[model samples]
Target: MFSSALSVLALASLCAGVLAQTYTIFFDNKCGRGTPTLVDQNGAVLSTGGAYNFNGSIIGASAFLQTGSCGPSGENCCTLKINDDGAGPECTKSVGTNNCPAEKCSASGGNLVIIFCD
Candidate 1:
């Protein structure tokens, strides 16, 4: 009985780990004097370097390349944006009064690389 219970526990642990999703954000800054930053909606800094790693999915998060008036978590910037919603991750572009339709992500899960000035 004890051996059976231990086997069950071990199986549960393995299943839990398998169910958990992992995500990595890589910032490729191909420009001058720019720092990459990722942030959430509640004004929390995720990463401020070349790469960031976390478990599970992210929603309403923002990424910014340190430059004029770009706030932490990527607020107040005129550029392309990506966010993961219920459907999936999306790529959006906002310019003036004309905003383009968001592009959906087909990626299952893995590393996300954001390149700046490239």
Candidate 2:
């Protein structure tokens, strides 16, 4: 009975790890300037690093390089938003980020790359 219980506990822990969800953020600051910023739904700062790792699903997140023109949450600028909920980048060639049209990315696939001036 004790052996059976131990085995069950071990299996449960392994399953928990396997079922965990995670994502990664990579900052490709090809512009060679400014700090990278990431913020949550409520405009809370998450990271200002080369990369960030997230656990579980992200919601209403935004990321951009702080070139002194954008907000802490990458707000107050163009609609170049990014989301964990499978949205894509804002703006088309005709619309332009300078006058963004609204869009974003995904978190389920587990990778988010934020580029600057490239």
Best by TM-score: 1
* Candidate 1 CA-lDDT value: 0.61
User: In candidate 1, which residue ranges exceed 4 Å CA deviation?
Assistant: 85-90, 97-109
Candidate 2, residues 1-118: lDDT per residue as tens digits? 9999999999999999988766687766666666767777788887885677766666666666676887666655543355554332221121235633222332334676655555
lDDT of 1 by residue, 4-111 (tens): 999999999999999876667676676665677766767787778656666766776766666656655555664445575433344455466222122122334465
For each candidate, the alpha-carbon lDDT, in order, equals: 0.61, 0.60
> TM-score of predicted model 1?
0.70
User: Ten-residue segment with the worst summed lDDT in candidate 1?
Assistant: 97-106
